[model samples]
Target: MIEVRQVTKRYGTKTVVDALDFTAKPGQVTGFLGPNGAGKSTTMRMIIGLDAPTSGSVTVNGKRYAEHAAPLHEIGALLEAKSVHPGRSAYSHLWGLAQTNGIPRRRVDEVIELAGLTSVARKRVGAFSLGMGQRLGIAAALLGDPAVVMLDEPVNGLDPEGVLWVRNLLSGLAAEGRTVMLSSHLMSETALIADHLVVIGRGRLLADTSVEALVQEAGIGAGIRVGSDAAERLRQVLAGPGVSVASSADGELEVSGLSAREVGEIANRNNIPLYELSSRAVSLEEAFMELTRDAVEYGKVAA
Candidate 1:
């Protein structure tokens, strides 16, 4: 498990991460989300001991990353995919990392096959494509067979198949009761795999909740889309305190603060004919935007 407690970081006069606190439990995929310049990278750096926290502490597997006798065996991370030497082959790069932490040569072969880099295992790193580089980075992260896995934008430059493979791999890791924390801007993909989310903005914690709970809290697209010949009449009937009825240009009514059953029963009592009534489930992207709207540092100015 990974625990970040009241962690803060600073550079010169700027604060990058501010009192951030969250726990990534084993047996679940926790998505770490934030906008650009939101201190996510700094926070990840602190977790892996790449940078010291100005305050508070970050622990992986119940101890500081540097304190672990075999740090790689405790937590494996992929912060940068292109950190490898260009002159080395994929197999050589992984082999070198394994040697540093006393990892076995067989484990190096295992991760190469697991990451689907077997065909290009002997290819020079400088000749590999972006997708292949990402695959190699992932292979390095799994080289230690660590209890905790952390990856940032693991799907970057990946094709649709590679994306699916990563989704399944993270899910499988969580199933084995490992602590899996991944940072991604792809909300749709994150929603499909992450059991929990840790969202930050402007160096502060914004949300720590389940996937369903966060979207529900946003209340975007949480209304019922009702279509009827008598839309105006239906709107009138549905109008009351605490209930909202909005009409679209296409003449459909979006009714909120009421359930589908409640709307149907009310319409039935009023003899309003309805052709369509369905709940508009909010997407994860919509919820993330709503929650972080005020925290965006480089927002576009409206004309």
Candidate 2:
């Protein structure tokens, strides 16, 4: 439901987002991710028409966000927290927003409940915690019941329970055939919530594919640890071209560049008894770190 075409953004002489092209489709949760200062916020702002693109354009459902007659009804965006005025109560704040968008009062109540803000709907926003403020912002976004919802770091200040709530909420929204796009720096959260991932590095599209595809394509070399009297022999047998073997102090070996089945076969053929044989693919975090290793601008020194 959302499309970005050659969207570029620059600041002064430096380009922050360069020729970005992608699509956020209905019925899927697209996770937008990148390292610090990777232009995620800028892109989100451009999508909602809060900021002008340097060259290209972004459209929601065939028209620029600003060009739509009922923009709030077409796209709901939560770019930052504390968007609500601190002086107003949560109910009044959403009331104003709903009114501004020509939405009915019932919509305001619907969103308040949807956002789990009924308990404190009459409280001033300034008294709310960061998480509460975030909830209020989300309520405002849902007031329009837009076809497309764009959230930038929706789980920033949420507790574990609140984070889980958002995860399920976004998944539910997408299941109903609405377009959902949110930028997050939390790999673990994205791994659990996102069906597809759009990875950016240095303001460029690093990888735009499903989370499963990224892990599979990385071919995370299987990790095998064995405890046996034949540990030395197993290491010797595993050492060769295409195979890498490293010995651990626990009298075990870490093997990579081969599958678990291959390792078992080699051990069996060589008459090496293995006390443990298991496998695991790379974590989403590791895969992402590997993908953006080159994009890292800072590094820690070895002690």
Candidate 3:
């Protein structure tokens, strides 16, 4: 498991990560979400010991990364795909990492196949495309078969097939009881894979909850759709403080600030026949935008 408690990082009076507390537990995939300049990359760096936290602590498998005798065996991370030498072949790159960790040559070949790079294992890193480079980075991460896996934008340069492959691979890793924490801007893909989420904004913790709970909270106050002959009258009756009723182009009543059950009960009490009434489900992208709207560093203000 990965544990972060009251972790904070600052540079020259500018705080990049605030007092953050969250756990990426074993047997689950925890998604780290934030907008641009939200300090996600900074936090990931601190976790891997590339950057030290100004205060607080971060631990993987109950020990700090630097304290581990074999750090790669405890935690495997992919921060930048371009960290390898451009002249080396994919197989050579992974083999070199394995040698430093005393990992067997068999493991190197295993990861190469697992990453679907057997065909291009001998190709030079300089000749690989962005997607191929990403695959190599991932293969290197899994070389140690670490208990904790952390990735930053693992799907950045992947095609659709590659993206699906990564999704399945991460999920499988979590199923094997490894702690998995990943940071990505892809909401749709994240929603599909992550069981829990840790959201931050402006270096502050915004939310830490399960994907289902977050979605349910976001879907609250979403408008309800009602199809009834008395749509006009129902709109007037539903109008109140914190409530809004609008007519769609199809003459359906869009009622906000009311739950589907409440709308149905209200119509029933008022003797209004309802043909259909359902709450509109909010998309993950929509909910994320609403949650981080204020934290967007480079967003444009509409006139």
Model 3 lDDT tens row, 126-189: 9988999999999988999999999999998999999999999999999999999989999999
Tens digit of per-residue lDDT, candidate 2, span 1-303: 999999999999999999998899999999998888778888888998989999988999999999998888999888877876788999998888878889999988898888888999998899999888888888877878999999988898999889989999999999999999988888899999898899887788999999999987775674666666888888888888988888778867788887888889989999888888777567788888889888764456689
CA lDDT, every model vs. true structure: 0.95, 0.87, 0.92
- What's the distance in Å from true for residue 144, model 1? 0.6
> Model 1: what TM-score?
0.96
174 Cα displacement, candidate 3 (Å): 0.7
Q: After superposition, how far is residue 287 of candidate 1 from its true place, in Å?
A: 0.4
Q: Estimate the TM-score of every prediction.
A: 0.96, 0.94, 0.96
Off by over 4 Å in 1: none
Model 1, 37-128: lDDT tens digits are: 99999999999999999999999999999999888899999999999999999999999999999999999999999999999999899999
Question: Which numbered prediction scores highest in lDDT against the true structure?
Answer: 1
Q: Mind sharing the TM-score for model 2?
A: 0.94
**What is the alpha-carbon lDDT of model 1 when measured against the actual structure?**
0.95
